[model samples]
Target: MRPQQVIDGDFTYWLGDMYALLGEKETALRWLRRTDEISNHNYPWFERDKNWNNLRSDSEYQRILADFQRHWERYREEFGDG
Candidate 1:
């Protein structure tokens, strides 16, 4: 069976984090994107998240990080939460 049902946004985010911790880069990113889509989380802590340190030098990971930055910028502009 799947690791968990991912019954909510928090659970989804946790799975993404777990995958990152396991060094499953592709799976981790897939789950992370799912979490972001479900919760629209800004993921401002991504750069500081130790779980993703292994991905820091990865070009794909950097792209994803840029995407997160852009997403947060848009979110802030829309909600004035920056």
Candidate 2:
């Protein structure tokens, strides 16, 4: 079960990133959003990944970034850094 969770998140993230690099914005966003839903960690890489540079100026991309940040804030509230 744990392995499946890891596999799902990691594989989905790769698919999303690949689609983004291939210029498939809509499909990339769909997979990327699922990566977030299942993994919840790839958001930090959004701004730093050169592969995503092409998506930087997209309105939907920005909205996704904001949504990821809000998700992070909620996570922090629920689980302190410790």
Candidate 3:
């Protein structure tokens, strides 16, 4: 099932979050990577999202988040939202 209103590429992020909530770290990360490739979201809420708390200690997750943070920061600087 899916929500009635969703922006492009959020489906992948939802899949990743679902997997993370289920304790499927690897699968979650895989979907997240795909989301990153597909949407490259600004990620204003990503770092603080509790959905990925399970991955907080994972190195790969950290790396991905770091990359997202860099990109998101740039996005904010360019767009003036943040």
Question: What's the candidate order when arranged by decreasing lDDT?
Answer: 3, 2, 1
**Candidate 1 local lDDT, 1-82, one digit each (tens):** 1424454756766777898889888888777666666654656887678888887898877877787788788888898974
Q: Rank the candidates by TM-score, best first.
A: 3, 2, 1
Clashing pairs in 1: none
List, residue by residue over 1-82, the lDDT tens digit for candidate 3. Answer: 3322334467878888999999999888887777677665647677888999989999999888887888888877898773
Best by lDDT: 3
Which residues of candidate 2, in runs, are more than 4 Å off? 1-7
Instruction: Please give each candidate's TM-score.
Output: 0.71, 0.73, 0.81
Error of 1 at 67 (Å): 1.7
For model 1 the local lDDT of residue 13 reads 62
Task: Give the root-mean-square deviation of each candidate in angstroms.
Answer: 2.8, 4.5, 4.4
TM-score of 2: 0.73
Report every candidate's CA lDDT: 0.73, 0.74, 0.78
Query: Which scores higher on lDDT, 2 or 3?
Result: 3
